[model samples]
Target: STGTMSAEELMKRGKRHLSVALKEECVNKNHVNLNIVLDHLLSKNKEIDDAETLEWCKSIIAGDKTYKEFLEIVKSYNNSSICGLVWTAEYVAYRCRTCGLSPCMSLCMDCFKAADHDGHDFNMFKSQAGGACDCGDESVMDAKGFCPKHSKNKDRSKIEPPKDLLFVAEIMIPRLVVRLVQYLRHSGAEKQYISKMTSFISFLQELSETGDLMQQIFSNVFTSQNDYTTYMISKSDVGVEYDIYEASLKFDTINVNKYFPELADDLIHKTLLDEMFFWVIKSKFPEHLVTFLLSILPNEQYKLAFVEVFVEHYRCMMVELTHSEDKSSVSNSVVHISVQLLSPLKLAIEIVTKFHLIHIMFACLKHIINQARYGNTLNLTSNVMKEHCYWPIVTDFINILAHPPIVQYFLNSTSLVNAWADVISSLQGLNMNRREHDLHVEFETETYYKAFSAELEICSTPLWALLKHLNDSSSKQLTINIVNILVTYLNKWFTENSVGEIEMNPDEMSFHYPLHRYLSLLISNALQQQGMELTDLLPSLEFLEILYLHPLHLLVREFFFFFVFPFNFVVGTYKICYV
Candidate 1:
């Protein structure tokens, strides 16, 4: 019904409608067939990607208000002896659902045979055939359903993920929403569903805003509901249980982090930091919560709470000037705890704003890095950065800038990439040649090149500055992480957009370039630097190969799995071998 049809088939149908015009044009001396043909072509082919044909069709559509008006033009053309009556052109701009790539939508039957293949899914753009394309449908690119740009979106995942993550709390929210909706629709709960309470909780984001007493009530209810949903789904009878067992209601993209507002700075003074921090850190939050909180925060006082907590925690962890415990001691303890502590809270903060608590956290990082000199740096053999602290600092840059607006800011700012130079330069100026270049363009480009070069330097050496402190005890895990960051940087740069690809072109004669391509190519080339044997992490080219095609968006799950679970196993094995 879709790609199965040919351009000629389309023309035939269009021509069938045009035959009426042909007769009229033959009867008259006026010339109008060209306009009529274009009108018929556009009416029959709206999604066609043939650029030339699309323009001609548009021209015809523009010339006529109805089929009758177009028909009059076509009829007049036949009467004129020397007029060009029949003309054919191809439209260009049809794109694939799976890949977002618009290959060619023309009817080039003879030469480009590949264009006739199942390159586009006309069904996706249509209503009946598309049915209900859900989030799980990740088949746009080659290996994954995500776009080729997203196929290699490992860096995107680093955006820590909001606390109530859809992916993480998947079983919970949908079930709750389904249960709540069902219960509301049924006999007794219908009134409650229609009530304002239901309307309010439906958008229940941070319970903290409901006042202290209500906050306490909501905190318990929220946890209980999510936990119930979690247990229900984990057991596999979630549907029956939610439908018959209990009643409730609920529901909930983008470079979302940038626009999201920060939590109120008073979070430390007003709320129980310990209580709130745990929930934020205890589980990956649902996307609805992330979005709601983000939506509310731009104007509310809650963001102050978020910022305060982050600042205080980091102060507790690393601020030497504060009348607190030695910052380095905590940093050392976090490494030795054998638990992933920072990630969950970091995830929550990231969901709210990419740079929300960033300045605070980064200030803390600087303090921690400064204090690391005083800590009992671990012994190392060959591998450096084998400790826990190394991974968090290096891995989450993408999550830090997942929202494009922030990225646009980076590209706009003349400020140099002082810390994660490679990361900053890689995403800057992506798809933005159209935006007016700033007066500081020369400065921005120069600083961008410097940061890009610096990132390349980091890729080449000092990768395991902290890991090396482990005293030559090798870590396959840490090695993989280091390599993993580099690989992802390459993927984003190479596949992000045409401008990024151009900026990332390692061969460019221009001084300014995307940061990560050089890093990825060098990292791939110098695998020996990470101490990974040929088989450890996949080669960069292979990651690149499967990065942007169909079915591999599922690989994103694998990538996260590698991030979350592999470290434990890899670390366990490495430690055991040494023992």
Candidate 2:
């Protein structure tokens, strides 16, 4: 009976069947035609039989939406305030057994309601910890499992990653792993290594029963449940256990540090470290991959090796940029990448201090400032400085130096102080440019001043630390340089606005207060020291008198009794003799 039916009649029957299967409101001709075409294309490509492909196609056709429209819907859903809320134990959450790729994947009530998982296997429970919603994470859940609110059809084949990253991840890392594996095969301890790996895996399995240790390991390995699902899917054929075993064998050897030695003199190790630095710079490696790479370092020696290589890489880049004739050709990405690599190593003071990272940073700052000072247009403050990433590099380095140990290193090193003074001198030269009426110039000037002000604020922490630790033994020149810079800042502020126009906010006034306090403390401490006289206070008193008349006077007066009393008493005696 089917064979006897006309072609047109068969088409009609197919459309009706599709409409019923898709649960359409009505049999619209356009919708039917679209579905037929999609089905034909999918079937011709032999993807119609694939469950996931079919599911995606069904969702697209049922919604009567274009790919772009579906993406827009997904974007809107992602932007929704309640969509990605992490539900805590206080709140009831839903988990779809059929759709969940892992136990960790759960949805908040709002996300659960918004998604279309009716008739599927699901459980509603009070979440134990904070559980992130996995509604739109296509890596973990099926497209068909997605609700109408969020549906995105991605063409994996069309995605193109950066070539450098691709080379590092796909080619470089794999090659290194293979070489390590080959080395392991030649070693006489293959049996022992395999046994140890087996024992380790069994231990992990035992730990998995307790949940906590296994969960932590999983969290370290996979940033999210979606990441776990994606990794499992991609490595399904090769198997994750074998990969882990291989990784363990590669790093388990006693001579592992030989391949990643502290110095970068060895060509192979140098290349590998350089590639790792590239990976860090690009920031293309996921967290799990970063953790895996870090795991290769069995001890502090190996970790220091990695840090040394990165620091050397940064140093070389800075040297080249500073020497370049056309400095503009050098990428500001060097600064950005350096910050990304070094900021995390802030706590690694032993390694950082040993390698003179702060010295390198100051050198880089001086170079950037010098370039800005002598660049074309002579005083193109923002464009030239921004082009070289002056502000970010300096600010980030200051943040890194905020650590106590590094600050101590900075204070102790005369070379670092000289480099800092060089930067300060360059800034002072740049500040000498005549003020321009152009809005752009005015805006840039304000930006530079604000950035400088913020840098001063951050510097106060280190300054105070130096004061407490060294007492009067701290570098007097460094203190004088800092005071001079503060004086310059005050002069600029006063020139910009009158004292009456200044805001009454203590927070606003706090910046000016620091200078007065630091100056007062320095003077007070000097007076307390032997051989210091009232005349030594004259210069400082004159400066303080200027500072005291500003709008910051109120806030300064508040803290005056606590920190500046010694200097205040001297000032009172000086005023009695003079005025």
Candidate 3:
């Protein structure tokens, strides 16, 4: 009779038998139902594979007809109460503080169990929801031990004072800002707070070897004026210097403590500083504040510390959006964070470029571009870049690229250009389904297209605008800078080390740039009849001649053949005769 049955029919028969077994044995029992049921199903059914078991478990969790009926038979069965124990486990245990206080001491739950944690005497241990085991203090496990313990009761009178007071002073800045804002409208209270802050600042200045740096850091925060006055003044209040620094000082008196507490707390400082960092940018406080903070710490280590803080804060906000289920809040929060970051980041790029801190700048830009390229939460990248305000930030960065000093610095080193190109190349990997198959790849062709189009537009906009204005008479120096930048880029391609493939096709004019349109325009505008004498063009021509002399990269050779060949043919004949 069983010989006629198919595999599917056998599975159904097995499931029926398993349901009856669960009803008879699992009723009135509060245990791991899934695992227990899985065991019972396989007790005699050796033919039931792991895949079949998983399918059955999924069906039960989805509230199958038989599973619901089984649940009804269990005594005092609340799904939540049992689901926790079922999914995780029961009875979490931690180390016992007392070795032999009671028989259950060693087995007691809820003690802190870090390897280096100091021991303590205690009674009943705390209870947690699930099965987790704890060993003794962390020192029991850490072979190298932990941080050095300083005596809490040591007298300060005998100890020499530390040379650097910046750490203490940095904490004071935010605390004082909070104090000043707390008493904003009340002049008497505000004055008193300012006096106290100034006194503390003076003492720190006395202690600091780098007193000038401390003074620079606190310069704006120490400047007190009526912050509330801006709100009082009407729109018609024009031509008045409203003390925008003070205007940005406005803070919620009641909730301000939540951000910055009166007592010293590193956590509160970190939280408040992060909020304040974003606030300064959003409120349009001068960029000098960021510059000052960065410059105060001037060394690479400190600048990197500040950059790490900015990046970590950004990453945290984005991670929160990734895990969140609330769609509307995610969108609003992302937009808020993105807009706040734009100005400060632009200012950061400018500052880093000015200081010739290429590595730090590259790191910062890489983080920004990567996040914006691959961000999937609520379509954050697309939304943020699409905003009108976002472009000004991009334009500011583009302006930096147009600046002669920055361009010269970048051109002298291929590392910066390569770093920038690497960021753009990361987008290409997102589109590489045709090259490699990944089951988990979230980026599809459409996503790649959108990102590619946006990236191209952003990278091209400023270059195009700058190139279009190069023909003006007053733009000679700008033209020289542009020429230097172009020549450097072209020179790299023509170098023997460069891979010598044609990157741009001769026919597809639309996709060609940074070489095609820029070169054509530079040469067209500099022609002998166009008022640029042969002398004026000699430097650019000489640079190109150098590129032509190397003769390795196919793009450079093709470029000479296609564009420069004709120009040289017409002009070199007459120019040679004059020579």
Compare the candidates by TM-score and give the number of the best one.
2
lDDT of 2 by residue, 1-579 (tens): 213333344345453354343333223222344334343433322321244433443343324443334334333322221123333234687888787653344666776777778788999887432334556555445666665444564322333322221111121122223222222222222333333223222222232222222223322332223432332224444344335433432321112122223323221222333433433322322222233333332222333455666565554445444444444433333432333234333324744567656555555555455455654122434454544444434544654654445556665555565445444433332332232323333244454564455335334444554555334534444445444554655555445445435543332222223444455665565566423454634445645555566623443434442344554664565446434
| Superposition-based RMSD of candidate 3 using all C-alpha atoms, in angstroms | 31.1
lDDT to native, each model: 0.31, 0.42, 0.36
Each prediction's TM-score versus the true structure: 0.23, 0.35, 0.29
* Candidate 3 residue spans exceeding 4 A from truth: 1-176, 179-275, 278-363, 367-393, 398-448, 491-517, 521-579
Q: What is candidate 3's lDDT per residue for 1-579, written digit by digit as tens?
A: 223333344345556554343333334342233334443433322322245544454233223235333223221121110000100123344434343221121222222332233454533434322122212212121211211221122232333223222332343343344332322222222223333334323322232223233434344333222322222233243222225434433422112122223312121113323334443333232222232333222222333344534443332333333333443343343332222222233334445453333343344344444445653221224444333222333433454454444544554455555554443333322332222222444555554455455545555564554454454555555455545555555555445323233333222211222343354466566562245654664456655554443322234334443454554553454345334
Q: Model 1, clash count?
A: 71
How good is model 1 by TM-score? 0.23
Candidate with more favorable, higher TM-score: 1 or 2: 2
Distance (Å) between predicted and true CA of 162, model 1? 32
Candidate order by lDDT, decreasing, is: 2, 3, 1
Candidate 1's C-alpha runs over 4 A off are: 1-269, 272-274, 278-355, 374-388, 411-579
Score candidate 2 by TM-score against the native.
0.35
